[model samples]
Target: MSLPLIGTLKLRGRLTLYVTLLAVAPLIISTWVGANTTRQMMQDQVHEMLRIEAEGLKDLVEASLVERETSVRSWAEDSLVREALLTGSYEQSDAVLSRLQLRYTTFTGLVLFTESGRAVSASTPALRDSFLGQDEAVRNAPWFKAAQEGHFTSATLTQEDPVFGMQVLHLAAPVMESRGGRRLGVLLAAYDWGQVGEVVKAALERARSRKNESFALEVRTASGTLLFDSRGQDAWHVPNAVAAEAINGPEIADVGDGWRFVALSDPEEVYATVNKLRAGTLVGVLAVVVLAALAAFLLARGITLPIARLNRVVRRIVQEGDLTQKLEVRSKDEVGELAESFIQMVDNLRETTESLQRGTRVLTETVAELTRAAEQQESNITRQAAALQQTQVTAQEIKQTSMVAAERAGAVLQVASRAEELGRGGALALTESMSGIQTLRDQVDEMADQIGRLNERAQRIGGITQTVKGLADRSNMLALNAAIEAVRSGEHGKGFAIVAKEIRTLANQSIQSTAQVGDLLEDITQAILKTVELSEQGQVRMEAGLAQARTSGDSMRALSTIVQDNMNAVRQIANAVSQQNAGIAEIFNAMTDLSTMMHDTMVGLQASQRVTEALREVATQMQQVARSYRV
Candidate 1:
């Protein structure tokens, strides 16, 4: 939920509310925070204490169990007990067990069993008879079975003995023969479960002693079977008390053989200190809020009362039309400064009002003087109006003549522009021709270089053709010599001569082909030389043409420039004539406007005479208004 908008409240109400909230909000928040913090701290302390108590109680139970087990093991190892087990005589063993049970009062009963699972003796006759009658039950018992397997074990569940009607925890230890480690029998001891309960009860008492708070202690088996509760309930039940009203502890500790120790406390008793602190803080915060509200109300009254008085005075001055009223400064505070400033403003207003009364009288006399002067100006302007009309007609004629001259000059400028454009177009064509000639010259030069390289290649080809022809000639000579040698050898020479003749034919064909290649190479070389010479000539001619075209382009550009200059001269002449014409037109318009203004002045003079009369009346009313204020 949101608070009301403070702007709607009066200053006093707003101040009271603001102060109350300022004082109470922090106090309430702090009280709530402190209360929660104290409550949590108390809960933590209680939980820690319960944990310690559970741990202490668990240790006590474990120690008691250990003591009982030790006592049973010692007695089981006694020579009399060992001999009785060996000889199947248990009278002395029964006496030894009875003495051990008496010495260790925590043990409710002690029983000794044979290796064959027969009860030989016990601390009490009832225990011995009950166990001996249930021989099969003894052998099947968990404690008995564990002892027979040579382990020291404790029964996790507690039971009420049928004969003694007491809760008992069974502990078993294996008895061994002295030599060769033979199993003799099992010693089973029943520890008093009440002793474990007493340990928890004692811890609860110690906790209660430290603080007068109700506390509970519980001992349970690992399966959640309640062995003992301080409240004396037989069956386990959930402690369903309200969380704020009770502190339920499951501060658990393992009390050997799977038993748990738990503790709980009453919430009301544990949180007493925190409750008191919260109550005190709330009371203090309420008192502070009341004080802050009271102070705020008084302060708001003090400040607003002065402003209210100033407001009343201002209203009276406005209603009565009085500038001479003054405010008195009662204190040297901001309110006092406001009062002093108000008084000064009133005095200044009074002086300004008196000055306005005097100024209004002067203004009335000035209006009369202005009225006479306007009439005199109207007459003089009427005579000047006639002279300006005649001069306007003469200026109009001159403007028309200048406009015609400007039009003629504009037409001449157009012709000159056309001539300049034609000259520029010619110049552009010449420039393009020059560029084309230059490009052609460069291409011709490149072609000449290509032709020269072609001639060199063709010349090399001719030399290679010559070398091939010489090789063909040498082969022909060799073939002819071989043919002659073959002819000198008869039939052997006939085959050799035929081969030589074939070789000579091939050589001759090679010679003819080489000659053809040489002729083609010579033709290509001549053509290349002719091409190079023509390219050189073309390049020289192109360079000359390029120079001539460049010269022509320059001349054309210069002629274009001259024509452009002539066009600019004509444009200047046209612009000057137009400017002169515009000047004359402006003069004619000024003369016409002057004549119209003269006529308007006559009408304005008459209107001014009437305005002067109205101003005089207005000044008289202003003087009356100023006089009304009591300054």
Candidate 2:
């Protein structure tokens, strides 16, 4: 299926492309921002955890020191150390020192200082078990001074032993007696600092979860000496490098070795929790995306499918030439109306085409019938002209015969008049026949009547000739006009050109055919002039033929007078000759006039035939022009 269009769009398959972007873009932005916030929050949480851990360690360490100090104070109040203190006996003090050492193995030493600031019994294993009488710790140290003021004392942790080299967490307390006795001395205990190192190591172990992490717990004397490091690295050794307040404990003052420390922590639980949260969110996001896509597909289909169908209808219009393949009237939407309008237009066009076809057919048939009639008319004209030609020929023959008869009669009558001069008995009888010549005058009057009617027919023929000449000229003009129209039509008039040529041919025939008519007219006029000339000739011939008649009449009269002279045969012969001669003269005059009239008629018919031919040519040319546009 081809994609649908929406204002030149080609990808109508997914309307939700923008919708998905709109939904997802902000979602992704929020996710990114949330992830960054989570990371910062995790860092802060770690920092908070570290601070709480350090504080907890400080409280635990302080609690452990207080317990140890209370235990040491109990030892200082012991019957053994007090008895030894009262007697001031070295052997008994040695016994007390041995007991103290045996009872508190956690301590480095237990020393009892007297009121005079001497160590009476010391857990130091060599030489006199005593602080010297002038020992500064016994006399003025905080633990010793507190003991003298009747307070139990706690000692600061020392990196080295009091009299040796081992480091210890020191604890000390005062000895007091009842029964009006006041404070006697201070008993101090030194613990191995190794225990503090062990506690720190344990806490470090507790803190560290993932690999490659360690912890530290450091302490120092007021004079900045190497005290302790839980992590036990050389970080404690750099003087002036460690930042102040790293440990944030009273014991941290004068710490020598370490500043910044890394606490190793296991990440298994943290990563597992992070993984759960991340996986759940990823699954939820994927679910949402899939749901959104499904919804998007459904939403897109509702719009795209209809559009696609509309597109197919439009394609049919373009490709198949099917204007009828319009969208159905599914709704009152714009596309539906547009399709309906298109169909209406197509229907109107089809009807118009049908009407045009019918009208053109009727016109074509009518024009064709008219053209055929013109052709038939041309045929009839040809036949008529041919028939008229025969008439003209007959007319010519009659005129020729009349001229010969009239010429011969003149010669014969002259001979007869000359014979009258030899007037003897027969001659005188022949001359006496002239007195009856007046009887021949009646025959002359009858011939003149026929001549007058022939002249009238000639006049009628002349009128017809003029009408034919006018028709031929009109026809020629029509042909020229058709040719001009053909030229004006350009290439579309090629068929018209052929028709024009045919019209010109027929028109050319008009000129040629009309020449025959003009010839006939000239012949008619010549014959008219001939008739006038022949009238005079006929008058002379009439005088001769009449003279012969007169001579014959005289001969008849002479014969009547000479009936007694020769009643046997000559008079009867003369009467028979006179009757035959008068009949011949009348027949000859009628033939001559009729021939002249027929010649004139032939001339007029020829002109008419030429005009008919020219008209037929013009119609033929029109027919050809019409045929050129047959398609």
Candidate 3:
């Protein structure tokens, strides 16, 4: 029922099932439809035939009733029957009625009644004796009353005399006079109801003989009272029976007083041919299903067999890892094309595998060469790293030596600076000494001029001393006169005389000291002359010393200039050495870095060699894999 479960079935089985269903489904449906249609048609036909038989039985019963009625009416119109009624005699009418009952066996009995309702004649002795004196009973009868009223009448179903004990129908007609057509007496006939049963039985017998089908017949009155049944009591009550009816009034008039005739037949017997057809259709459907299954199985095998073979070849190629396998093409259908394409693919794969084998060999050789080259490069890089390390160490020593030389040059520069400062100080001192010597020379020249002026002033002072000596002599003369005057005055002149004597003594001492001063002035003049000569000589020497001191200052300044130049040169040498030391340090650091880089390069080369060796191993593995294939 599930599609997955159906898919797991073999192709032939699935195809067979589908084809069988396709073939048999319509056959079964048509068989069922045809069987039901046939059954309905057969049932209708059986009912139609029964209806025809019922109609025929109805006609027979009508004819019998009409014949009985005609006979009774004719007998009522007979001249002998009118004479017997007119004369009130019985012999002749009795013989006529007797002959009539003998002529028609359907009639059970015949009787005649007079105008006053007296039974006069009868067809048999029992019929005559039973109704001969029953004038009131006869006159009160419905059929007898209707005959007296000049109408022919038939009575409802009733039983005959106890001697016969059978169902019958009553018919009556009025006797009329010849000239006036006056109603005289009544003639009544008891027709046997067994005649209707005989008609139905005969019809049933004919149907059974012709068609060999079982049938039943029933006769009933207008109110459905059962009169006759050919199937006997309660035997015609079949539930599935096909039945048809013929009523009395529509086909035949006044037969059995508006009775019904019916015919029945069984349905199972009616549809027998249709049942056989259904059985035969089922057999045919089964045969068609079997044939369809066989054809589908053959078709499925034709389609799947070639595909199965292709699958087997694919599996073998995969398991064996053989690209050299080929396929055989047998047909020009799509399956054959698939096989051809598979063969082409296999050939292409074989070629590709062979190409891979050759490529792996070349790759292996290349990897081996690369590995050898990497190893040699690694060794070379190792030696280069050592050389770089040694160069870095030498550069470091050079940097240290340059630093020491720069420090020494700085010391020399500082010493030269100190010496330059000393020389400058010496030059300044010499310049100051030269200025002092020049100042001394100027003062010496001034001193010599002052000495010459002093000598001239001393000569003027000698002339003054001669004049003072003359004044002293004059004063001594004056003093002697004053002494003489005093001696002439006696008392006043004594004091005056003492004063003159003292004055005279003082003048004499003045004269003596003046002479000594003259001699000293001459000596001072001579000494002034000598001092001027020395001052002139000293000025000359001082000028010479100032010139010499100026020369020494110039020499000292020149020496200071030379020392300052030397110190500048020393400073430049120290700076150059300091810069050189820095440059050497930089070179040392660069060499150290170069050495480290070379070491790293060597390590990289060794790693590359290992990678190359790994690549060679991979190539060898590839060669092994390629060799496994046959191609």
Candidate 4:
């Protein structure tokens, strides 16, 4: 949808809008999409890394529990512990328990309890004072039931212990008979929960600082009791409401029995990076839009300024009727070519106008000179009429001289024969000249055909040049992609990188060569254009010359008629001299009138032909100027 403001904006705004549509919008969309994709990918990678670390921590905790279970089972089967529990012999059992405690220092305390929850022996003397028989809490404990069921159980319990203050895990193993396999008592070992927490914490720490975000480490029981939280926000080792909220979000790994390693992920730190990327993208997008808008404005200015100048020049010419205005060609681009063409058009028009003016002046002078000569001929004919009247009176007086008249008639007949020979020769010359003109016309047509063929070849060359350019561009793109892949391959792709570089260089050279070929084609096209134009002009001139030659042939036919008329007049003069001298004056007057009329007609025909040729040239030049514009 377009905004209302868009319609109201000028050329600059339109250009800016087009630029944004063409350049900026796609950039923003691609950048945003790429950033989001990267963020999702990175988030998935972080989750995978955290899960792997969690699994490792789970294995460590399980190994710790397994080792404690092994030690407890071995002690539970010992004869000293069984004797202490069954026979109430604490001296030997305590000695053995002390030795066990010394070997595994992580066991804060150890105890031997009977099947009925009575304390048999203790590893620590201080904890022994508090050991109770018939205690409900001890008998009801989950680990106690697990031990009676002949299974090793690790149970996390929070208490204020002297050695390991906040929380401890009790590892229990059941003691049984060697032969009958009867239950005897339970052996218990207190492993500080802090040791297990250190393992979990270490695994998390190794992964936490690597990427994405910071997270809290937590150890919980299957019953949703939070045992150890690295956050240290809950020092009492109590179940936290906030921490429970994250039970669904946190990733969990089972340590053993019911205990779990939970990592409560906090993504704020990781998303902070995504936020920064988004901010930078917005900033860069804004920068690109600003730059694009600025370029659009400058581009609009460049185009409009030239158009305005051209319009002003055209308007001036239209108003003033001046064909002398010319535009300055500032660049070698389309606008410059348009200006150059317009200048040429105006120059051609001016030259044609000047030629017409000169032709008109010469025609006027020719008409004036012809009128004066005709007036002089009319005067000479009037004097010859007066002479004919006197000659008639004199000839009537010479009617008696028949012999002289007959001699003059014989001489007149000889003159008539000579004139007939000259007329026949002139007619043959006219026929030969017409044949030469026809040959010239044929040659002109053949030249036009050859020039047309050259134009076609030029077009073919242009297409070939374009094909080469496309191939070069494609090769360059392929080389660039190859270089990118080589760089991605790092040290292994050094040889390929060298090959790609050479390919790119060759592609560039090919592109340059194609461009040079294209320039040559343009030159050829221009030369062909000029040749065709010259041929057309020559054809036009040849046609005009043919027309003039035909006109001359008609004049020659008329001259032949005049020559026949002169011969008839000479015969009439001889007849008048021989028969009646009275008719001689009339024949002489008729000859003088015919001569004056023919002279005037010849002068008018010559002037008309000259004017026609001049007008034809003007029209041809105007057409050439008009052809320069394509549309």
Candidate 5:
């Protein structure tokens, strides 16, 4: 369906495809933007968590240092240092140093200098050996001099050392008499400043400062002597301008690195603040994104489901060629009307096609009937022609027979005339003979004239018979020519062609029958010849009879004039009887010739009718064959 629709664009709607594309474009754009937003928000959330974690550990380290300092200060006020200094015994001093060293790892050296600036009891063997020696640091150190004033302490810091090496927190206090308040030597306690340095390095890790973001430390005594400081060329600084704000007090500050910044000092406080913002923002964004996604899913489902169903219906109709399928769209919209119209159109087209087929069938039937009738008529004509030809043959035979009879009658009549002449001569001689002779002579004269007329009549009948025979022959020839022409015409002239074949048969029959007529005519000619010979012979016999009649007439005229008159009366009766007999025979022969001609004509017509009838049948058959060619 999709491929065929691409082939024919007319079925496609004007705005349907465009509107779908329009809807899809925005959906795609919205999905992309939403994904990007969610990604940015998640990254922000992760970074904030790392920063807050860094700030949290920073505060814990600071608090640990403060507690350490307070614990160490209170420990120094014990009577252990005064006792150690008063005894100064080798074993006793070592005992106190060892005892105090066991209390803490921050201590490096604890020494007591004399009023003359001499070192006294020490915490370690090496430092004890160096005591009472004039070392500038041991003799002129801030702690050494500060002990003259009593109870002055230095902050924990990085500082140089002479007796036991570098130190951190150094505190000094004057020892007074138990009874009168007299001062013993000053008590000096040196702390390892490296311990404080460890605190600062620890702070850097806890603060989450980069390896390049460094830290610095410094300390000053009350007399203005610099006591401890964490300053070295190798030190990695806690580098930041925002650290200046932290320097004012113990509070959090924003430290600016070139690319970014962070607040520290209150490690937990910064963590709590930034993390609160991060968790809230993440949850809010998540809620919004989830809501949006759910709404989009629901919306897409709602819109696309209807469209998909519509597409399915369209595909089914197009693919299957089933116009009966209609849209099931519940909405009363344009698409619904379109489906209805399509169904209606298909129904109308089917009905119209059926009606057209019916009309064509009726028209075909009418033409077939008319064609059959024409062929039947032609067949009838051919049959009639055959019959007509038979009749013509009969007529020709009759005409020839009549001619022979007429010829014989005429010869008899001529012989009768000669007898009449001989009869008049016979009447002069004998009376009895003369009476018969006169009758014979009168009959001969009348017979002679009648015979002459009969001969003429025979000739006429013969001429008429020949003419009718010629006409019949011509008609037969014409029928044969027509048949030959039809055979030459091939299948196209098959109707006429069969008619021609029938005509040929009719012609052949007519020809044969005519030949029979010719044979009968030949027989009639022989009979005529026989009649002429017979008539001549009859003439001779009649002549002999006429002479006898003449002698008799002579006798009658001589012997009795009255008898001669009676003989004259007998002659008149003989003349009338002989003449009537000859004339009647001639008329009968003429009638016979006419009957033969008529029969021949009838036969010719019948033959033609037979041929024509056969032709009509052939025409009807041809029409039927032609009808077979139609679908």
Candidate 6:
């Protein structure tokens, strides 16, 4: 799911996020660790400081108690107080106690208690009358009891005195003689709680002055009773008004006798410094992150901008169908190299396209030439077919004429036979027969002349057919050239190549047809030569028959022989004419074969024409396709 979401983000957004992560990850971790370490150091320092302050306050309390006890002991051993106490003179002791109390202002009042629990002397008249130590109770009193052990001592704590109406501490010392060491009495000195409170406040003030303003202090008894608090608020809990708070138990030092000096320092003092450090570190980290992000943004832009440009160039090429577009190279980096490569590719494409267009033009021109040639060949074939048709009709006419001439020759022979039988009977009959023979000779001469002219026309047609064959060969060469050009055009030339192939096939067929026509023409020429020879022979026979008829007018026997010779020449003429007719029949068959070949040639020409037209259409289409692209 996260993968898809990340994929959908834009490159810049993702890059920026990644850059920020890369830049800030270490910063965040280091900041967290540093804050922890700093807080710990501050806490350690606070604990150490609190511990030192509490120990100092404890020492101060001990020193105050020791000073008071020493003063009381000195006063108890005074010579005047000792003698007075030994003699049980309260008045004399009162004078000494009054003077001693005057010298030590911390002493609230001084009293003398004997071993029997009697108040022997008192500095304060009210304490003398209201003394709780009346008899056995005085012996059991803590101060008197401690003094009775024959040692110097003092009360460990200051407490409230109901008779004095004040808080006071009592100090007791024994009064005894030096030599005999006889016990005299107990001397008790009272120190006010206000004096102890003042000493504790002064000691704590000194500690407070050593720390910053947020530092606070508290003193408590061993039983967790609050003795003094710097903030005048709960020593165990923070006040609502304070920005920073303290926890209970703090750091404590024992003053002595179950008394405690509890010190508390507000956390704001440490947190203030820590907070400043944290703020500075955050600013530094943010600066680094901002700089890193800017660098990443610039870097991302540098890379992606060029890629976008290249993409646009490619799109333009595709949309416009132009291959000549080139990319600009501004740097010697990978993107620059890519642009260079793209330019090279487009150049190559342009060159290939130009080559193809050139080949197409060549092929189109070649096909056009082939088309023109095919059309000309078609025209020639049509003309040749028409001529052959005419020739066929002329041959039929000549055959009929030859048959008529043969019948006339036979009639002339019958006339010559009658002339031979009537050779002694008359000149007039012979002259008439000779005239008919002369006319027969003239008709044969005319037929021979017509045959000679027909042979000449046939020879002319053969020459024309040779020219057509030459044109067919030329057209075949053109088709082959077209095919070669089509091959050079690659895929675009496939259609053209097919058309060229068809044209070449038709050209081949035409060549074959032309060859067949040439062969037929050769046969017709031979037949015409044979017919000319037969005509020459029949012409000679006609002249001989004409001479024989003229001779019959002069001599009967000579005429009869000449008539028989003429008859034989006429028979020979008839035989030659029959052979000539048979040659003409062969010539007619050759002409028919020639006509069929011409028809096929005509069909082939028509096919070539159609193929050429199709090729032209293909070239047109190719040009249209090529035009869609720029060079």
Instruction: Please report how far candidate 6 places residue 421 from its true position, in Å.
Output: 99
Q: What C-alpha lDDT do the candidate models reach, one value each?
A: 0.77, 0.59, 0.80, 0.72, 0.54, 0.74
Model 6 quality (TM-score)? 0.44
Q: Could you tell me the TM-score of candidate 2?
A: 0.36
lDDT of 6: 0.74
Lowest summed lDDT window (length 10), candidate 4: 241-250
Off by over 4 Å in 5: 1-80, 87-90, 151-158, 196-631
Q: Give the backbone clash total of model 3.
A: 0
Give every collision pair in model 6.
Answer: none
Count of clashing residue pairs in every prediction: 0, 15, 0, 0, 76, 0
lDDT of 1 at 183: 85
Model 4, 210-244: lDDT tens digits are 65235556666677676777667644332421121
List model 1 lDDT by residue over 1-631, tens digit each. Answer: 2456666787778777777787778888887888898888877887777777766766666667667666667776888888888898888888888888888887878888887778888887878887656778778888788777755544545567664578776778788899978988888887777776666667667866878446777776666777767767543344642121111233432225666777666666767788888888888888887888898788878877777788888897777878766677787789888888888888888899989988988997898798788778767777777777777778778878888988888898889889988988898888778777777777777877887788888888888888999999999999999999999998879999999999999999999999889888878878877877877777777777777787787788888889989988988888888888788778877877877887787678778877877887888899888877877
Error of 4 at 142 (Å): 1.9
lDDT of candidate 5 over 171-245, digit per residue (tens)? 666766566666766656665656645655554564455422333333233333443334455543333222211
lDDT of 4: 0.72
Query: What order do you get sorting by TM-score, best first?
Result: 1, 3, 4, 6, 2, 5
Q: Write out the backbone clash pairs for model 1.
A: none
Can you give the TM-score per candidate against the true fold? Answer: 0.54, 0.36, 0.46, 0.45, 0.27, 0.44
Question: What tens-digit string does per-residue lDDT give for candidate 2 at 1-631?
Answer: 2334433444443466655656766776777677668756765675566555555555555556666766776787787777777777656666776676787666666666777677666765452343564576557776567666655433444435556457665466667775546666667776676776655666676656533253345554335444556656544333322121234344532122232222323343333455566677777777777777678768776656656776776666556545344346565666567657766766775455455556556665665666566667657666765766666566556656655655555555554444443334565555544444444445545555666666677677767766766777777788778888889999987788788778777867776776687677677766766666666566676567655665565665564454444432433444555555556555555655655656565565656656656655655664544333222
> Model 3 over residues 374-462: C-alpha lDDT tens digits?
87877777787777777887888888888889888888988998898899889888877777777777778788888888998898888
Better of 1 and 2 by lDDT: 1
